[model samples]
Target: MSGAFFNSEGISALLQQFDVSKLVELSKKVDLLQVIKNLNSMDDQQLAGLMKVLNAKPKNRELPEIDGDFYDVSHTLTPEQRELQLKVRHFMETEIKPIVNEYWLKDEFPFQIIPKFRELNICGVTYDGYGCPNLPFLMEGVLAMEMARIDSSIATFFGVQSGLSMGSIYICGSEEQKQKWLPQMQKLEKIGAFGLTEPEVGSGAAGGLTTTCKKTDDGWILNGQKKWIGNATFADLIIIWARDLDDNEVKGFIVEKDNPGFAVEKIHGKMALRIVQNGLITLTDCFVTEENRLQNANSFKDTAKVLQMTRAGVAWMATGCARGAYESALDYTRTRKQFGKPIASFQMIQGHLVEMLSNLTAMQTMVFRLSEMQDEGILKDEHASLAKVFCTMRTRDIVSRAREVMGGNGILLEHDVARFVADSEAIYSYEGTKEINSLIVGRSITGFSAFV
Candidate 1:
């Protein structure tokens, strides 16, 4: 017993104990199935002995597959939506997962993924025309979840391009503007970026935008700096927002990339969403012709409309981040062992896992209904803000627990969960900061603006 069983050739002894004489007699008279049946009839010791004699490893009893969808959200999807969701999920797992870490580490956008993304044909999903799918809001939320599950940077990139940039034109663009931009943007032939947040303005963008656009004889001249403009570096067209000097009201401008006065420097050394190429944009007398203006985006209300739509999408993306972390942690727990037992068996470890799952499930359910309300045309600014605040807050917690349960290994990028942890910070702050979103809800409930 003191010696190592492996070194002494334990199989030979166990085989001897099996009584080979009896097996030869039994096998000669029986079919293979009958022999297996006879083996099944043997006692535990006998069966173990036979296993040793056959030099076969004991069959592993696999635990049931861990599902992060604690609630049956998938059950709610229509067959088509579910198929599309799975398709995006599979693409993320196969195409994005392998190369994501490298690109993420380099803080560079993977331009190559565009062709694969176009193949998905999911761009302009949930939009009405211009070669778009016009799908339900639920499908839109599901697609966001699938993308963030593998890579939040890509999800953010898509949200900026599809949700903010394309959505702005879709919602506020005149017929002509939509006709010009939507189809090409939908096909990813021309990438787009949204520029609203400036260096001096973030959560306070609505009322305080200092970026000014002046009316000129020729058209309008835009002059200001926009911070954290995702995809601005290579976008064919940028949706630039500036307060009109005459009316003191915000307006959206479609600034083409080649505009002489438009300059972009990649905002570097970001801790979160590294795969996103956020640019610090300098607009110096950038002249956009009257035709390029978003004809309907006359005031802050128009800009707010665009933010409201995309903010809900961000909430869904936050849920995706949490779900990805929770599922990754769950998978790791089952396979990772300590003291001859899975670490998942420990009470404290199970507690952390459960907490992560509960938050993730709650976020998933909340976002589902938020999208439902959005589809029904009943979604308000406060409604989207509520989900954004709640889901991003809970996502931060869930990802923390996910990393905590993994101990030191959690911080490593290769573990997969770590990236979610980092990306959650960006999601928490981008569309509306947690504080800004909370104030939106607070103002709605209390009938008072707490922003000041």
Candidate 2:
């Protein structure tokens, strides 16, 4: 054998494969010369097997996917529904994800995405006719979660259109009103906004809506201000709810955006869901013909139906917000090194991750059942309210932990968790607050109204 066979490179490679103590022990062996002779005489196959173990890089134990759907609640979805869920997820990730942060920072709606929404063909998903797919309410809930999982602002925008605006028309509009508005809204040709939350009325809207409408010789004249009206600035239609002056009951009107009596100021300096383009609308005797009135929305109770149907969707949106934050924080912990190892390998980090997953799993299971109830025609006010109260509260916690795990980087928008964290606060306060929703459940369960 040539002396070059045992040169410095060979020795250096051999040292990497063994501990120094083992190498020293082998070096001191009396039969070390015999060991070299044995190596020279070995068969090629034997030497190849011996060299393979020493030369190969350490194999990494593969990690499972960091999916927030830990309990597989979505597994119950039909194959078609699952495919559609993934389709929406892909659209948000590819199209909206790139521009969401920019629009969010600019406090402006991405008008460009509205045309793309037409391509998705999913607006007005739950309504039966007038170009709607009339899919199960469960499908609607899943789609909401899927959209929110990417960006809550987009999800809120969608909920306003599909749930509040379209739902009011679907559940309360006369047949003629439905035929007029739904098909175009379904195609995203006309964006819509729900105007129930007045400047002075939110939870009190059920009884104390100051926005009033009076029967007129010409038409109903609506006068009031609506605050936090999402999509109002650019929406083609705004569904305005006002107290009837003659009857003292709540009624709905489909107000056109360009009405001479209707004006909206874009709300600025918001810290969360900034891309939603929330507006404060002033209606100075906004006149609508009797035909534009939602004929069946006779009182607050009918308007409550619209709210009941949409509040469940808010719970699903909360879950998506939490899911986004949790997944981002989890992936971050797995890759981020601290104290010479991945932070995810630490016990405390794993503990936070598990807690987040546990809360998220609970929220998902609750909404899954909640949607089933809606599809079965059994969903009630307290039923939706309870889920909203619990899920939104837990979402706040989940996002907090998500930010906690990410430390400083969690607050930055590029990491995505910060956006979820900020958007979640809006979800918690909207539709109904924790206190108001709790009172709804409290009134239902104990036969007592705690709401003041």
Tens digits of per-residue lDDT, candidate 2, 1-452, equal 43345556875686688888876797887675677666766776777887898899998979889899988999999999999999999999999999989998888888888888888889889888899988999999999999999899999999999889999999999998899899988998888999999887888998899999999988899999999999999999999999998889999999998877999999999989999989999999788988889999999999988999899999999999999899989999999999899999999999999999999999999999999999999999999999999999999999999999999999999999999989999999999999999998999999987777
Instruction: Estimate candidate 1's alpha-carbon lDDT, on a 0 to 1 scale.
Output: 0.89
Model 1, 1-452: lDDT tens digits are 22234233654574577768886786688774555446546776776787787997668878867777888877988888888989999999999999999999999988998999998888889899899999988788889998998889999888887899999999989999999999999999999999999999997787999899999988999999999999999999999999999999999999999997999999989989999999999999899999999999999899998888888899989998988898899888888999999998899999998888888888888999999998899999999999999999999999999999999999999899889999999898888888888999999999998888
TM-score of each: 0.88, 0.88
Residue 193 in model 1: shift from native, Å?
0.2
What lDDT does candidate 1 reach at residue 268? 89
Candidate 2, superposed: residue stretches over 4 Å from native: 1-56
- Clashing residue pairs in candidate 1 are none
Evaluate residue 429 in candidate 1 and report its C-alpha lDDT on the 0 to 100 scale: 89
